[model samples]
Target chain A: MSLLQQLRLGFRSLMLHKLRSALAVLGILIGVTAVIWLVAMGEGVSYQAQQQIKDLGATSIIIRSIKPSEESSRDVGSRFGISYGLLRDDYERIVTNVPTISRAVPMREISREVRHREYAIDGQAIGCTPDYFGMNRLTIARGRAISEVDMKGYANVVVLAWEAARKLFPIEDPLGRAVQIGTEFYVVVGIAAERTAAAAIGGSLDARQYDRDVYIPLSTFRARIGDRVFTLRAGTTQLETVELTQITAVVEDMKEVDATADIIRSLLQRYHKSVDYAVVVPKELLEQAETMRAMFNVLLLLIAGISLLVGGIGIMNIMLATVTERTREIGIRRALGATKGEIVRQFLCETVVLAGTGGLLGVAFGFLCGPTVNGVRMAVGAFLPEVWSALPPNIRNLEPRLAPWSIIAAFAISVGVGILFGIYPARRAASMDPIEALRHE
Target chain B: MNELQPTVDREIVASIVGVSKVYKLGGHTVRALDNVSIDFRQGDFVAIMGSSGSGKSTLLNLLGCLDRPDSGQYILAGRDVAAMDDETLSRIRGRYLGFIFQSYNLIQQLSVVENIEVPLSYQRPPLPGGRERCLKLAELVGLSGRLGHRPTELSGGQQQRVAIARALVNNPHVILADEPTGNLDTATSHEIMDLLDALNRAGRTIVMVTHENDIAERARRIVRLRDGRIDTISEVRPALPVVSGSIALERL
Candidate 1:
């Protein structure tokens, strides 16, 4: 028989038990949909992580000074104070020694309360050079950033971050006004534009919020704030000294990021007594994110494949029952001169129809993944505000990215599952004795 | 009783020689057919009759190529079909034989015309004018008006007529009917037999198995089996003159 005729026959036969055939199709539909939906969600999460890493600049390497533990700190300190962190000399050495370094910005930050008049808010005071604004992609919205003249003369000038400007100068413009920071008054020169938080990369980098920082020239911070600061910890007054907190080095070429990072790591190892620093290359982090995305997709595929297998098993079960129930029809066709191969083709055609229909329907539903996720997010945010607030920023901001490959693979595998699971039942129906089948009640 | 031989002047379409079939039923071997032999000529109508387990059904099954004999040669259309493989045997059956069942064995899902076209679907090289041929056969069996009706919608006699139409759609060398009127009332039985009689008169070859003597009398010859052996071969009517120069005769 022609394939078309066989398919028509198969469809007609399946229509005899409509509910049974529909249930079988539903099994495959669920499996295919699961494959597509899970892969989309996984891709969205990994995409978010990779984008954050890319925002950090692929050619930049961040070196942060970490405080040593108490045991390691005791040996490096004198009775005056314990100082175990990057010094001003390390910054100079890295800039002069690394040939691939295009530009390096040294920064030191301390948490303190800043006030203008009676209004006060806790904020970070960042001490850095003029290049720090350009390297960090921070733009100025009002007035101007700290200039080269301000750094050369150790001028008492500051730039307010977006949120800091809004809080300290709530109703009035704070430009040319002085804000007091720990008994020192610094004039505001500029206000940085608004910026979103950057996601944490692995365990080395913490999630950064840029809204509450107050910027000043490195020379001014060293001369005014000084290196020594006293703090009461556990009812004891302790003194700590630190010069520079971080150095961000930008490589001229992306290919030299890893080699330059290695050179800087060895140079620092020779100078520091203990491991009190971390070198983070955004380029390396981007590569790791790519690898993680691949592994996540593979894991999703494995889980989807199991569900498809279960769906295939359901198809086989239904088909076996159909073969048994239609034994007499098989006999009739055989008696009318149908070959064994023809019988097999007929049954196999029915299964392909079942699986193919489910696959198509599943693909249609997969396209709804993005809208469904957004709808659920909105519903939770509206009805259960506390629970929605409790969700991590990643989940709250997630956008399911439907991968085209997942759609195609899911459809092809569903049909393949049909063929793979269909063979045995088709063969069973074909091998029955014609006389016995005809005589079957 | 002596077995009658085929007339030498007529062309033989099928013949079985020294055929025997044995079956194992619950570990006990039952001889379904024992050393049976017969010849069927073109345009001939023959009926096989016997009591239950008398081997009439077994003989029909062997003739239909549904079962292979334990020992013997059964030739059809000049081929030794008994030795043929399953695939070749199926091809032979599609090319040379048609079947009508007692229960009107029409596929429930198919309409009358579609059921009639079932045999043609199995023909190798595929028969042409598929729907047109089914329509013509339905008209021949007086079921043209019920072409779109399923078997369940038809009466017993109408269903049997549909089966008869299906048997002729392939235009085989022999048409095998297993108790064609077995499930019909007497009036409906006569109606179905009348359709068969007309087809037989139109130069078609038919082989029927029935337990009713009256039903057997409709054919030209009746062969009775007893205890797995042929008991008698009787002629109820003389063979009609074949319409020579007809398309069927020309093909043969």
Candidate 2:
């Protein structure tokens, strides 16, 4: 028979029992949609994670000073208020030795109570250079950030973080106002924008909360605080001295991040007797996140693949019943000069049509993933604001990115499933004895 | 029983020599047909008659090429079809034979014209003008008025007429009818038989299997079988003269 005729015949037969064919098609539709939806959601999640790592600066390396363990604190200077961790000399040595280092910012952070017209709140005072704001992705909401002149001339000026500005000033403007910090007064220059805090990543970096920080120039901090602070603890007066709590060095190119980090690590090891500093390459973390995203995609695909397998089994189940029900029809066709191969082709064509139609509908539905998720989010937010707010930021702002290859792959696999599950039933129909099949009631 | 003279002037369309078929049913082997030999000439209408378990159905199956003989040679239009593979046998059946079943085995989903077009669809070089040919065949079988009707909507007699139209659509060399009128009433049976008789008179080679002696008497020759063997092959009393040119026209 002509292929077109065979297909028409098969279609006509399937249409005779519309409910059965629809049920089979529904199985395949659910499978394909599940694959696409799950993969899209996974891609969205991984994309958010990678974006977070990229925001940490892919071409920058961070060196944080950690106090050495007691076992390694054998220096006799400890009794005389001798301090540990990275110092300003170490930061200068890095900028001088590493040719790939394009720029480096040194920061020292201390907690202090700030009072502006009786609005006293404990906040972090961060001493940094002009490049610190951009390197850490902090934006200025008002006025201007601390300038290079503020650092060079040791200007006693400060920029208040978003919440600090809100709490200290409330209805009044905080710009040009002097805020008292531990008996020292500094003028506020600018207000930083509100930023979401980043969670600690892989034990290399601590969680950073930017909303309550007070920014000051490193030169001002060195000239005023003097790196040595004495405090009364229990019954004894204890003194500690430390400088340059962290150094964030930016590389000229991403490819040099690892090599420069290695050079910095060896330089620190040569200078410091104790292992009190850690060099962290955010570039390496970005690559690790990429690998993890691939693994996540594979895991999602495997789950979707199982659903497809179940769908294939569903097709097989329905087809087997159909073959049984049409035994006499098969006999009639064979008697009507249809070859065994024609019989097989007829049944296989029906299944492929079922799966192909379902796959097409699934691809169409996959395109709706982004809007669907947004709609669901809106609904949830309207009905239960608390629940919506409780969701993680990654899920709250998820934008499903449909992979083109996944759409094609899901469709192709569904068609393959039709053929794979269709073989046995078609063979059963084809191999039937004409006389016996005709005799089947 | 062997005194009948074979018509030598007619061309032999099909013949089986020493054909036997054995069936195993529940561990008891049944010899359905044993050493049956017969020759069918072109343009001959023959009826095969037997009671229950008389090997008549088995003989019909073997002649229809639906089953193979355990040991024998079946030659059809000068080809040894007994040794042919399934694909080749299907092609032979499509090109050489047509079938009508007792149950009026028209596919219930198809219309009369679609059912008739089925056999023509399987033709390799696809019989041209299939719709026109189906319409013509429907007219020939007196079903032109109900060409679009499904089989379930038709009376038993009309369904059998559609089957007949379907059988003739392929323009096969031979028509095999298995108890063609078994499911109809006496009046409808006669109506179906009249159509068959008219087709036979138009020079179509027809082979019919029936249990009714009255039905067998309508054919020019009757072959009677009992217990897997042919009991008699005799000329039936002519109820009507062997008339030719029932419809005067060019043959397909």
Candidate 3:
């Protein structure tokens, strides 16, 4: 028989038991939809992580001074206090010694209260050079940033972050206005633009917020605030002095990041007595993110494959029952001169119809993943405010990104599952004896 | 015995020579057909009659190429079909034989016209003008108005008429009917028999298996079997009369 006629025959036969056939299709539909939706969500999450890493500038390396453990600090403690961290001399050494280092910026930050006309807010006071603003991707909203002249002259000038600028001078523009920090009044040279927070990358890099910072020239910070600071701990006064908090170095070539970081680490290891500094490369984090995305996709596919396996089993079950139920029909066709191959083709056609239909419909639903997630997110936010608030920021702001390959793979796998599970039942139908099948009532 | 002789004047369409079929039923050997031989000529209408297990059904099955004989040769249209493979046997059946069942074995999902077209669909290289042939046959069987109606919607007589039309669609060398009227009322049975009689008169070769002597009397010859052997072969009716401008069976 022609293939079209066989398919029509199969379709008519399946229509005989409508509910049974629809349930079989539903099994495959759920499997395909699960694969697509899960992959899209996974892609979205990984895409977000990769974007954050990319934002950190691939050629830049960050070195942060970590507080050493108590035992290490006690070993290095002097009569004044424990003093262990990146110093100004280390920054000069890295800049002068590393040939690949194109530029470097040194920064020191401390939490302090800045006040203007009885308005006070706790903010991070950052001492940095002109290169720091460009390296950190910070933009100026008003006036000019701290200049080379300010650093050379040790001028007492500061740049208020967007939120700090808004709070310290609620109604008036804060440009050229003086704000007090630790008994020193510094003029606000500029206001930094608002920036969204960057997510933390493993344990190596901390999440950064720019809105609560007040930037000042490093020369002026050292000349005015000095390096020594005292704090009361357990009713006893302790003194600590630190020259630098962070050093960000930029390389001319991306290929030199890893080698340059290694050289810097060993150089610091030779000078520092304890492990008190961390070197982070955005390129390494980007590679790690790529690996994470691959693993996540594989894991998602595995889970979705299990569901499709169950769906395939359901198809086999339905086809088996269909074969048993239509023994007499097989006999009739055989008597009418249908060969064994024809019988097999007929049954196989029915299964392909079932799975192909489910696959197309599942792909159609896959395209709706982004909208569906958004709808559910909005519904939760509107109906269950408390629950929505409890969700992590990742889930709350998730944007599902459909991967084209996943859609293609899901549809192809579903059709493949149909054929894989269909062979046995079709063979069973073909092998039935015509004489016996004719006798089957 | 003379009546059993093959007539040299007419063309023989099918013949079985020294054919025997054995079956194993619950480990006991049952000889369904034992050393049976018969010749069927063109335009022949033969009825086979016997009691239960008398081998009439077995003889019909063997003649229809649905079963292989244990020994001897069965030839149809000059081909030795007894030892043919399953696929070739099926092709032979499609090319040279048609079947009508007692229960009107019409596929439930198909309409009357599609039911008639089923055998044609199985024809290798497929017959051209199949749908037109199906429509013409349906009209010949007086079912043109019910062409699109399923078997379940038709009366028993109407369903049997559709079966008869299906049997003619392939233009087979032989038409095999297994108790074609067993499930019909007397009036419906006569209606079906009339349709079969008209088709036979139009030069179609028909082989019918029935228990009713009255049904057998309608055929030109009757073969009776007892205990897996032929007991009698009788001429019941004269030769078919030449009819003018009747329904021409098209070679689809």
**Number of the predicted model whose DockQ against the real structure is largest:** 1
Task: Report iRMS values in order.
Answer: 0.8, 1.2, 0.9
lDDT of 1 by residue, A1-441 (tens): 778878888888888999999989998999999999999999999888887887788999988878788998898788867886788899999999999999999999888889999899888999999999888789999999989999999999999999999999999999999999878999999999997766574253445778889999999999999877688899998788888888999999988999999999999999998988888888888889899999999999999999999999999999999999999999999999999999999999999989988899989999999999999999999999999998888899899999999999999999999989999999999999999999988
Candidate 3 at residue A28, lDDT?
88
- Worst lDDT 10-window in candidate 2 chain A: A198-207
Off by over 4 Å in 2: A1-12, A66-85, A109-125, A133-145, A158-214, A223-242, A270-277, B1-9, B26-28, B237-252
Instruction: Give lDDT: candidate 3, residue A385.
Output: 100
- Candidate 1: where are CA atoms >4 Å away? A77-81, A113-122, A140-143, A159-194, A201-206, A228-239, B1-9, B245-252
Q: Could you report the DockQ of all the candidates, in the order they appear?
A: 0.77, 0.65, 0.74
- Of candidate 1 chain A, the 10-residue stretch with the lowest lDDT total is A198-207
Quickly count the clashes in candidate 2. 0
Clashes of 3: 0
For candidate 1, the per-residue lDDT at B175 reads: 91
DockQ of candidate 3 (2 decimals)? 0.74
Q: Which ten residues in a row have the lowest lDDT in candidate 2 chain B?
A: B241-250
